[model samples]
Target: MECCAFCPTESRELYKCPKCDRLYCSLKCYRNEKHWICSESFYKDQVKEHKPELMENEPQPEDSSSKNFNPEMFEDYMKTFKKDTRSEKEKNPQIRVRADEDILFDSDDEPDYVRVVAEKSLEEFEKIDMNDLDRKLTMAGLGGLTDNDEQLEYLYSQLNDEEKKMFNRLADNLQYDEMGLMNSVFGKNLPKKK
Candidate 1:
């Protein structure tokens, strides 16, 4: 049997989330899944508007001309943004907003299953943040290094032998032709488009 989405060690009896229909071993995983997927999935399904098909006679993928050619018909896709008259609750929210009834303030000594699952997710996020933070802090001292070679030297010295091999592979592309990339951005210092 497939393990629960949240708990891998548990496989006995799993409950399915009503919104997205994801399986969970414990009620806590089911609860946590609510904040992450359930609530959004429920409302999203309810309010989803069916869009009409684009075209019946659309060109096939294998046709080369259809792929390369741009339609000359349209000046712009839209003249103005359509005004969304729906209230805040009707619209897709930026962040997940749980209904008041969904939230349970259970006050027991030990952390509940939902709290454990949420904490685990939080710890993983924090670990990613710290690693990125460390890299930024190290890069912040780059100006103090005299040149690009010196900066590379500092970075290489900081790496282990295993990481040094990866670093060398990354640096391999440093000498490749950059003319196309440079042209795309600077555009051969082209004349201004009127």
Candidate 2:
């Protein structure tokens, strides 16, 4: 198990910092002196992501040429919108919210240890897999799907037996759900409406 980069606790459950990618065990450790810079930057990044318009200039209004508005056209638009929404909801009745899972790990459960290293060293690698490339990039260990496979394999390898069992169960559930969603969306083997 890898120890928390901030404090000396063996992190059973870990969260990777969005900005720095350093592993921290808890919120306290995440807000610590060493990790504070990254935490602050991560917060900023999140804000920017969620509210990108804050950085960009305000959008200009539509051209006055659209002043010739039609109420009949808007009524037709609303009818089509309602019809589509109702049909969509009826088509995907299997879509429902699932209960939230308790995946958070508490680092305070374990005894704290003094910080061992003053500064952490980064290991440099020659090859970096860029996951946004063309389909041919998959053969070179790149592309989104390839990256996801690699990540899942690495995380699965890090789990214990119990965790592995839970992970498999979750994966099975996800697979089932995915199949159901696909079948529903493509109107394959759907029950006839009475």
Candidate 3:
């Protein structure tokens, strides 16, 4: 069953608005609802006005070639182009209007689902102690010997299955390239070469 974009009601029958491409349950629901799709007649009239030449099958004058076109024809073309552009801008006024007043702000009454999910993910991420490894590495650095193999093993063990796979792939690529795995792991600045 398809749900109406505007309303909470769900229906098996989906009626798509020709103008805005929004779906509705019934004609009555659509008629009563305040949606951008309701302005279909206005758009239809615009379509009619913009393509005036398409509406009629008038034959071009044999004497009036493209090279010999009058200045009036050029003026008419420019006027038509300007009118069409203006009509398009008028149709989507919200997009063109820079003022905050002209913009249609979403109601704060409804909570955004995607935003809620993102916030939850961020909260979870914040709870994780990412600096724990760095602290451990810093303490280990106090010792003269920085055990790179042990550090790599520890880091690799801490990673999830997907992350471990990616790490392994990177290690494989580094091995195939005949460069120090340390250079690939810790970047060029590190003096360690293996």
Residue-wise C-alpha lDDT for candidate 3, range 56-136, written one tens digit per residue: 753444445464443334355344332333543577765666554444445543357667877999998888765765676
Give each model a TM-score. Answer: 0.23, 0.26, 0.20
Model 2 per-residue lDDT at 116: 22
- The residue pairs that clash in candidate 3, if any, are none
Model 3 misplacement above 4 A: 40-194
Compute the lDDT of residue 177 as modeled in candidate 1. Answer: 33
Residues 48-158, candidate 1, lDDT per residue (tens digit)? 534224333433443345444433322321212244578555664554556753323344333577688788999988778655665676688635554689887887899
Distance from true position, residue 28, model 1, in Å? Answer: 23
lDDT of each: 0.57, 0.62, 0.63
CA shift at 135, candidate 3, in angstroms?
A: 90
Residues 158-186, candidate 2: write the lDDT tens digits: 89999998878887768867766545656
Compared with the true structure, the alpha-carbon lDDT of candidate 2 equals 0.62
| Candidate with the larger lDDT of 2 and 3 | 3
lDDT of 1: 0.57
Q: Could you tell me which residue pairs clash in candidate 1?
A: none
How far off is residue 74 in model 2, in Å?
Answer: 54
Choose 1 or 3, whichever is better by TM-score: 1
